[model samples]
Target: MKNMNQLITIAFFVLSTNFFAQDKQDQQNEIVAVWITADETKIEIYKEGNVYLGNPINSKGERNTKIEVLNLEYTNGKWVGKIYSKKRGKLLDVECLVEGDNLLLEVTTRFISTELEWNRAKS
Candidate 1:
């Protein structure tokens, strides 16, 4: 009876550890449904292959913009991406994080770095 109790305890410990590990991974792997920039440009981002892509959509009855966000990669708690500006005809480095109900974005160029906050558009 004592040996059986020990075996059950060991099994329970292993199972509980695995459960917690899976839960932590799930939290890290969560994807934001949508994010809206301060300028009221709403975008839907999703993972495709190994990178993420974003598409603009209408917000508050405003016309949907044709701009697109591309080449986002997540690693080590930071998101690395690029935003192409049609006006400048260049791509800028963008880093982002999902903090609470806001998406914090940092756009960095050769001469300057700008940080912007995007509100979560969906749960």
Candidate 2:
């Protein structure tokens, strides 16, 4: 009887862990929209099929800039992707997290690390 109870406890823990992970994934998946940074830079985030992308827009709402975020995939509780730097003309690895009303992005490279905070834009 004690062994049976232990087995049931282990099963419950596994199920609950999966449930919470799925919940977090669902929340992260809902980040398909436009967001504004603290410096008023406008970025439009969208998903094309399974690929998540981001582009910067100008005052005229034209996506004339190069893609900012590309090939984003939700994995291990965060969005892992690549960000294109127009100034440097290079690609950098990026990780994104949606925290409360903010989207936190971290960009990393061999010698540089950048963190950006963005809020969902109001339509």
Candidate 3:
């Protein structure tokens, strides 16, 4: 009976350790970017920490919006979030994922897609 209890404890600890390690790994691989599309212009996003701040830097070189970060979702290997644009006064959702050495981004509501090479910024 004592032996069985010890085995259960050990198994629990091992599983907990692995789960946490995987969570840390997933956080480390998150991505942030300034996405550009033909119609809407730009979107600024941060995947990890579930943070997002979207604003159009320049719409045809003219200011057109006030933007703020909204609640974003962060999955182990996926990012999906929505941003509120002051110019349009609306929210737009986007999805992103890592594929090998490239980053995949798609704004389904807008039907726009882009693939950008991953460049690690000096931390």
* lDDT-best of 2 and 3: 2
Candidate that would win on lDDT: 2
Worst 10 residues of 1 by lDDT: 58-67
Q: Which 10 consecutive positions of candidate 2 have the poorest summed lDDT?
A: 62-71
lDDT of each: 0.74, 0.81, 0.55
TM-score of each: 0.70, 0.68, 0.44
Q: What is the lDDT of residue 55 in candidate 1?
A: 71
Tens digits of lDDT, candidate 3, 1-123 = 999999999999999999999987666445554555435455444543545444444646432345453336666557677645445678767566655434455544467543433332233
Prediction 2 global C-alpha lDDT: 0.81
Kindly provide the TM-score of model 1 when superposed on the true structure, using C-alpha atoms: 0.70
lDDT of 1 by residue, 1-123 (tens): 999999999999999999998986554445445778787877777776766777777646442446666458777776788987655789899888777888788888887998989888764
Candidates 2 and 3, the one with greater TM-score: 2
Candidate 2 lDDT, 7-63, residue by residue in tens: 999999999999998987677677777888777888888777777888888889876
What residue pairs clash in candidate 3, if any at all?
Answer: none
Off by over 4 Å in 2: 1-25, 62-68
